[model samples]
Target: MAELQFREAIKQAIDEEMESDENVFIMGEEVAEYNGAYKVTEGLLDKYGFRRVIDTPISELGFAGIGVGAAMNGLRPIVEFMTFNFAVLAADQIINHASKARYMLGGQVSTPIVFRGANASAGQLGATHSVAYDSMYAMFPGLKVIYTSEPEDAKGLLKSAIRDDDPVLFMESEQMYGLKGEVTEEEDFTIPIGKGKIKREGDDVTVVATGKMYHIAQNAAKELAKDGVECEIIDPRTIKPLDIEMIIESIKKTNRCVVVDESHPFGGLASEVGFLIQREAFDYLDAPVQRVTLPDVNAPFSKPLFDLWLPDAKNVVEAVNTVTYRK
Candidate 1:
């Protein structure tokens, strides 16, 4: 195992995949000459040359469409949106064309493309820029949604996303790029999609968290441990095709659940997970499932207001306590 920052793990994944597969290439604004918006593609332009490491105009829709076409024609393209907030401009291509091509054509064609970038609020980024699109994209069929929280998971899952024969929406966090974690040095490392990992083991309550929210859940778990509450934290690395079975297994052991998500409360990942827990593990549950998520309002730009709006460890701790019926 090797320690790598979250961004470095992502870069290593792309580097390894592109090195082995000539069909693999990457394109997005500032991806080449500018070394990527977050420097995740730094040095890739020189390593792979302009043909494979490409930079395009500031048009998300145009380049995204090109990426879909390239994938349909046999090239595996990784399309980066500076931030998913900007990807809203290209939703027509991603949701309509790329996602439907395989199904509508009766599996005659495979859109083996990966669309990735930072997602959700990164500090004071206001309403429009802070929207978490994980649940939104996961709702559509023919698309795979992977939101990673750890460096190792980011590296392994991305490699799988690139190799998948379907469209994948990979969501990362702007604030977590600097996070460091141990990643495997194994060659061709790839984690299977739709598999959830138990980050921490416990028996008192099951805490399901994803992306940046996983860290918040971790902090909450640590605090709860002081009062004898043990939380088994499960990170659903893939949002769509959720690993509900693993979650159900955890719930059977714990009999309580608290889902922490960065998305808003209504129609969010937490909503779906909470529903599934009640449906599949209803008999095992000892209490109602609780959720810690952004309220039903746009992100606030004001620092204090944003802090209030954002769900944090305190919020997760409260939710966990609620599910566990603790004071």
Candidate 2:
């Protein structure tokens, strides 16, 4: 019955994973002596020393490539990006090399590494920092994309990502890191990748959300329920090898769906989920699958402009109402 912040759970997962596997080591800026930008790696340096908990210069590209190289050479490295936006500097190593190395090498090497930490809009962080790139990264061949919306899911999936034998992109929302939830003290209780979890049950409509948008969809659901509309909410925890089958099944029962995501509308997770539902369960859908996402604009620094670009409860409620033909 103990409670932990979502960020704390993430720290716990990485800490335990390192203890369980001697091959595991962590590297990033402020990770060793400073504990980490968000304190997720706090006390690691004191426990493991500089050999394992390394502090690098502000070079995401260099460190990420080093992690990739380590994974190839038989060590398991967890590369933490201060924020995924900074990871843009490491795109080549991440998308071209780390993602395709195993397949390009004809399945000879395994990249058992985790590239993770905060992603998406948070406060006045502005255009360059606020954009979420899960869609861009998830498009790769040999990569696993993880998007957890809760504390428990964050801990379990992050642990699985670290232990898996392929390169994993574990995205965390900066806003959700401080939110508290229940997490088990067990060492390795992991949630399977490429699966969807149903958070709420309903017969009228399905609202599929990922990352921070999952909480928005849940808030909208509570409001809609007061007006006699029941909503089934599904969270596709991992984007690549996505749980499309679960979405197809949910749409079949609800007959209508509104996918909510924190990213822009085009080429986003919602777009992919919508296309999947159209292909597999088109006959079952009573209405078209609508998406609730940020407007296709660069996230602005101004408070009002940023709010306009972010998806919220009002938009989610409207999207569901439109899809369910409720006017």
- Tens digits of lDDT, candidate 2, 40-64: 9999999998999999999888999
How close to the true structure is residue 308 of candidate 1, measured as C-alpha lDDT?
A: 94
Question: Model 1 reaches what TM-score against the true structure?
Answer: 0.99
Backbone clash tally (model 2): 0
In order of appearance, the predictions have TM-scores of 0.99, 0.98
Clashing pairs in 2: none
Quick one: best lDDT, which candidate?
A: 1
Predict model 1's lDDT versus the native. 0.95
Deviation (Å) of 198 in candidate 1: 0.5
The predictions' CA RMSDs to the true structure, in order, are: 0.7, 0.9
lDDT of each: 0.95, 0.90
